[model samples]
Target: MRGAAMSLSAAASGFVVFLLSVSVVQGQDDWGVTYTSTEICALKGSTVDISCTYRYPSRINDHITQVKEKFWFTRVSNNDYVDIRSDPEYSGRVQYIFGNNDCTLRITDLRESDSAEYKLRFITNQHNGKYTGSPGVTLSVTGMVTDLQVQVSRLLVYKSYNRAELKCHSSCRLPDHLHYVWYKNRQKMWRGTSSYSVSVYPADSYSCAVEGYEKFPSPPVYAPRVPSVSVSPSGEIVEGSSVTLTCSSDANPAANYTWYKENEVSPKASGQIFTITDFRPEHSGNYYCEAQNRRGRHNSTLHLIVVAGKFLHSATHILYQKS
Candidate 1:
């Protein structure tokens, strides 16, 4: 009976030892930090968030404790890590979000100089219980090109013909190596340089953006093309008939229309449509409509001829009398 009791006691002792060994192995396996992503990209003047989760043994050397200190560092020297939040460059820009075992670092108003590798470190109340994540998160910051502007210039070629010159501009100056791209009505038209010149008509719409960053393009600026003019009562113009002249142009911010007669320096009418209550020979002359906006202006011309009804009847009567 004594031998059986000894065997039972030894078996119970070995079982306890085995359970302790399993618990140690599980604790070691769960006592490390992990990051969701090791690399991230952010736009300059924007914000970024780095996330991670960490763990530690609940009991170290038979003593229970809790986390005492947690911070993020960009560099370590001589077993000492420097906290990024304490740096002057990151002051007021760095924020920490801490949960049970998860942590997040948010940086706002990011600059190009802020790009670097960041590591998370934590210390527990237990003696000599500190850990730093093996690998850190690397951030790359890039600038966004904005405030694009378009400038237009007109040069007289010959007689009444004029040539247009267009140049794309941006408030933020980028590297000279970066090129400019031009878009016509949302379609890629030119790529290479900032300036593009062409004889423009009223149907052309233009926008511009940087070469690498095409998603954010400048608001379209229009080069007013020659306006299309239409006169009411399409056939022969008769005396004492109301006539309407309509002008239309394809332009950004819409085009302002002005009507003028040939050799007249002032506009005879305004708006997209011009009305004449009674048509007469005095109104018969070369007429033109101008389409204009802040970017540019263009004009189109048309001629009108009016005939009196009495003149046609008098000619017919004279022919009958001669016969």
Candidate 2:
């Protein structure tokens, strides 16, 4: 009776081993299959996907069994899968993409550090005490832009403080990822985490800037735009005689000035100076200047009054009488 009991115990142990072996070969469900992903993805800052497809080799393509649970493990993306269960780093953020061969791995806010290859596979306990899985898919995420682009705008431009109009302009723009700031001579003028417009003295230089994502290549520094200016000769001229009028102005890129004759409707866009060599009644009138820049043109008026003939004109007249 004792010998018979020993035989029965050995038989039971052999049976258990056989079952375990079967689980290992049949892949838990004894479907006799192994699966893995042949797909590959690029890099971070961009996006990539890992997909898996499998079917039983023992059965026809149409007879393949569907593995309900599929998941992936990533080294860099930190993406997790819920259907196959994943680590905490990727939990909640991952989900099984229904009706699709690929799972939805929404990597929020892509960063540079998210770079690495990932593993993919399926899980099953169809054959008790055994679990089956497919090989992992290798992927690489690449960073596209080394720096973030910034948009810039100017709120005010002027010449002499308060005397003329101050102008601001929108120069360049990119993705709305950056905050705008203004500067002059390397000094931060306005911190517009809120707005872009600013008013300041004309003597100071200016520039606009935008920052976003804390990335490099913020914005290229641009020279400030300056208002155009014009002026007549600084010295005094003889009365009843004509004086040559001159106009000038300063601007970022140089500006153009056109001279308008007083009472007359045409412009003398010629020499810097308009010389009326012969002083006469017609030589005097309301004098003004028109200044132009990339933006457009503007006018500044000068009320010039010519005095009576001076000693020089008198001497000339006397010489003419003698002749």
Candidate 3:
């Protein structure tokens, strides 16, 4: 019945009808996945490994085990992903770093133009049938610049105070891991996490250094790197409550925030903040924000409490900071 569903009877002669039916049936046939690349893109001009593993459906793999073939499909822009072998432009730049249930790709010396979507694809035979694969990893490339930026927030500088703490943020980078350093007036300071703060610089110049695969001039004094962060409010305040999470971070490039909750990573989750425009006891959770800089991430142990569950917008900031 699986294959027979595509056959059009004499009762249906329209090509559009046949095509529509094929699409509907094929929609149910999907590839399986397990592991995925923790990070999709690396620093500008660096090596990136897009890894993915999969287990075919029991009906598709029966008891089969050995893999017999492998290949890849590169997404050009949108709507089409073709073999890299056929495109002269990507010929030498693309290489199969490794292939298997865990297929990976090595894209070297990435340039801005190299910035786009990529994947690892393949196929293998199993006892049940031909275990063709739709399994793969997504890859994105980013630019690497040593130049840094400086910023300060909620600073309480006292008069005659010998020092003030200021933060640095590096934005526009996509690397998953790298080393971050603090620099002041051309000298290296202590290396902390991505968020580096030096005792007040007396109205002087400061910068940072992020070393990875990006190489150019003797890495100039870059803008300071900021850590990925989000602000949340306390949840105890309401039914029909309002909230917002301010996400800010430092990296050689800007840090991107992807919100998550419970068991859902992306699609199943909703809202930047859990806005209980209408209060309900069901709106409670151990809520927290996952902040990530290009190099690492930090999670706050936070929870949203809906006491008596009343609704109001004034408590948004309090609820947001709760977690």
Task: Say which candidate scores most in lDDT.
Answer: 1
Q: Estimate each model's TM-score.
A: 0.40, 0.29, 0.40
Segments in model 2 whose C-alpha atoms lie over 4 Å from true places:
1-177, 211-248, 253-258, 261-281, 284-288, 292-323
**Candidates by lDDT, descending order:** 1, 3, 2
For model 2, the local distance difference test gives: 0.38
The local distance difference test score of each candidate is 0.66, 0.38, 0.41
| Candidate 1 structure quality by residue, lDDT tens digits, 1-323 | 00000000111111100000011111245466666556666557655667677888899789996999999988776878988888888998888888778787777777889889888899999887888876677777667666677777543343333356777776443434457898887799889888888654445567889876798898887656557787776766567878888888777657788888877799899999998877777777777777777555777776776555410111101000000
For residue 209, give model 2's deviation from the true position in Å: 2.9
User: For model 3, how does the per-residue alpha-carbon lDDT over 182-299 read when each residue is reduced to its tens digit?
Assistant: 6665566656555654444222345555544224212232222322223334433545545544434333223344454445455323333433344456655544444432223334
Q: Residue 278, candidate 2: how far off, in angstroms?
A: 11
| Reference-based TM-score, model 1 | 0.40
Clashes of 3: 31
